[model samples]
Target: MKLLSPKLLLLPMLCWVQQAAAQQTTEALSDVQKIEYASPGVRGMGKPRGIVVEYERLPQFDIDSKSDDPEIGNGSARVRRHNKFSVRALAPIMNKPQTKLILGIDHSFEEFNFENVTPATYSLYNSLEDKNLKSVGLQLAFLHSPNEVNFYLVRAKAELNGDYTRDNINISDYLKTTIDVAYGWKRSPDFAWGIGFQLGYTFGRQRVYPGILYNRTFNDKWGVESIFPANARLRLNVSEKTLLYTGYRIEGASYNLLASNPPLSKFNDIELRRTDFKGLVRLEQEIYDFLWFAVEGGFRQYYRHRVFDDVGSRDYIIKNDLAGAGYIGVEIFAVPPRRFTEGRKNK
Candidate 1:
């Protein structure tokens, strides 16, 4: 089954099962409703996920660092350790057959620890040691089915990413926002397509781009899900309890960082823009009634890593070219009870 559209892809669980089970007493859904949120009796979307959490500690990787200023002189850079943590939850604000409103929240934190054997070099590298980045986001997803065959998907998200502590946090300096709206058609229970415009920082900066969301289920064992230009995955249903996926994903972000010590003492703050493109494989297995665990491994290619003045007083100050590195992550999430979904299917 397909996940959320590209705009709302940050939270990829499709749990409308309880809603589907409750809808058994209601009339048939229009074409859009069936495709956007599949009926339980149909073999379309999968899972009734509620909460998801992920953690990863990427290994030490070599990095080649350069700067717009040659006088700062540097030798090499290495990321000694990188730790990432994230969590997300989704709940229905309003659920109906014709219209659905879902609210989701996501929080993420990351730490980059640089290996510094000798401190006699570049100022930028000195300041980059032990840097931290954080983000908290809110998203509202709206699925509207006006008629039988047509549907619309609208999603908006606002995030704050930065290095500021609780004492000095400023909303105006760290807020980043995005919006995605697409028009889709339900050709059948197992196929759907849509096109939409996305305005956000998917490439480490602000830009507007068009995307095509295509989902197809070939059989009980095979499926494909994608939002073009951002993500795509091939799905394999090995059994009722296990699932596998191999796909591509792009991650991008801009963080406002504090300027405390040397090197950046002149500026109030600096901005870090980064993007990563990866191809990966994932395996998901049920752990208990509603608990599931997943393991993912991938090779990440750095697309952009740049630094600039936050006040827009100057052009980019630094650019680093990072080599591709292999990465791995693990996750645990909650899905609806099997009894509830099975019950809906037998209806």
Candidate 2:
């Protein structure tokens, strides 16, 4: 056989080399020590010492709507409001000299309201309903930071949530679980950064009503489906208290009916998938031994894909593009009285 072109023959090898190099870089960078400056507090404990309370509020407006059909509606005015409050309690689960455990709980609520001025058509319509979504999660983290050889953090979290509508409609209910592990180099105390990996799974059900008229008309034949979801987050730390985070998330689900389904269309069965990319920058300042404050801002982009099945024939139906609103929020931290005293005594 004639020899393959040099470029084509080298393409696969080059790709493999690049991937291996990236993996090696991540592993090599994971163990570098962060620089720490002299401060008036404890120096060695990598654990959150006290209870911290954080509150965030983001009010935003959007000028674009996902619907592309100009007659149905081109642009829509929308507002989103989000609030989060969390309480973190830190204590030594195992009092061994080198290992520590921390626990935290966070509760948040987000609401979306869309107003479509575009004249309604037979093919497209606006719901004019507000969407309110809520999420609550708990986390348990274990940390091991000793001298300068190895630093590791392992954490697990679980979250539950309801649908995002205000029309007395329950679209979906979901539960998510995540586990993350990170290894960092022990160098200094002031600045440190590391690459980490996260794995998550989501289980949920999307409820579809029959004809949108009866409240109790549950369609067993059109029941919701379960899905396996996975996402990843990149973690960066500028200081012990400040963090920068970025992540990509995706959720796959199926719906038996489209939002614009006609009254008599039994062929409304559809499957939906959503993907999102988000970035966040946050700064934390310690106000006192027991209290801290934080500010954060971020943006998100989302994509939605729909597939439909009609009369024993399946086809790609619609693709919607949405740009997520940006948000800024503030957080406050509260430490237990004893932890405060301990820090003060150390200082």
TM, every model: 0.86, 0.50
Candidate 2 to truth, TM: 0.50
Where does model 1 exceed 4 Å of error?
1-45, 70-75, 116-121, 311-314, 343-347
Candidate 1 residue-wise lDDT, 1-347, digit = tens: 00011132321322232223222322354565542343221243446557889887677786666665655434466778778888888776876756778788988888777775334455665665676677888888777666556667777888787876789999998887888767777566667677777776666567786777677778999887777777888889898778899999877777777867556656678877777787999998989978999999988887877778663334777777777888888999997687865676565
Error of 1 at 18 (Å): 15
Ten-residue stretch with the least lDDT total in model 1:
1-10
Candidate 2 lDDT by residue in tens digits, 1-347? 00000011111111122111111111112358532221111122222434545555545544343433333334344444434444444444553334546565655544344444333322322321333334456767665555443455566666544333345333333354556555544333222323344453211122211110000101221111101123333344445444444443333222222344342133343333333433565555656655667776676544443333331123534444455756566767563444544553354
- Model 2 root mean square deviation, Cα atoms: 17.2
Candidate 1 shows a clash count of: 1
lDDT of each: 0.67, 0.37
